[model samples]
Target: MSDLPPPPRLPVTFRPGHTRAILLTAGVVIFLVISGIAMLLEHLGPGSRLSFILTGALIFWALAQLARVKVVADESGVTVVNIAGKRRLAWAEIVRVNLRPGDPWVFLDLSDGTSLPALGIQPGIAKQRAIADARALRALAEAHSASSALPHEPRS
Candidate 1:
């Protein structure tokens, strides 16, 4: 009776497409502007120009990190790659998937007493897409966990 779409096939990846594109574009633009300004500043010494270019490169690297956020689901488990860290979880380890209103991204409640933030499915420029992604992920987790659980025991 649920209206949500079926879970995606294994080896699926969920990511904020628009956010990645925008971040990449912004990074390139910022790097170009900084390099251009450095080149145009004839009065600046060579060291200063190099510093400016290096700064631009560093900025681009940081932005690229954010753009790389994603969640990959395979037969083994799900891998969540955030800005600074990546964590892998077995399907049975995920107790629930949450993307409540006003949340920036999806959060996974683990069987352990911990909640993991999944930045890959963020409600940035594409809110609806993020919701769909979250739902799909949830469905995948539920399906996989249910099949893996022993029939004699209840799922926690």
Candidate 2:
């Protein structure tokens, strides 16, 4: 038998910062507040259908951006949240995890021969120490896999 290590297990409980969601949400809030004040002042009367419609649209868009993203792990496998939503995959189901520093996002390498969409790990998040943070997460995933006893043997 060949000696090999198993894949890493994702963090059982993890939540990525929803920066896009938050920003969009804040914009909606501010717009509504201003609109309300304008209407109260009679500056924006009831006939201001355009302003009302615009405000409603912004609120809806914010809600859409507010996606619940999380990564969960267990003895069985790991679950990932992508554009399609959350999906649970076993360790064997996970082909690889390629977390390269590009486009300010983290992409996952899957087993079925598909690349998972990038999750904004560093979306608009610029800092002198962001590199360190990104590396740490990659290391954590590697360590988790190592600790989980996931096999690393080549298939023939």
Those runs of model 1 whose alpha carbons end farther than 4 Å from true positions after fitting are 1-4, 152-156
Candidate 1 C-alpha lDDT tens digits along 3-54:
6678898999999999999999999999999999999999999999999999
Candidate 2 Cα errors over 4 Å, as ranges: 1-11, 18-21, 24-28, 34-38, 41-54, 57-67, 118-120, 126-156
lDDT, candidate 2, at 99: 47
Model 2: per-residue Cα lDDT over 91-138, one tens digit each = 655545544545555556666888765343443444323344344444
Candidate 1: residue 95 lDDT (0-100): 94
Whole-model lDDT, model 1: 0.94
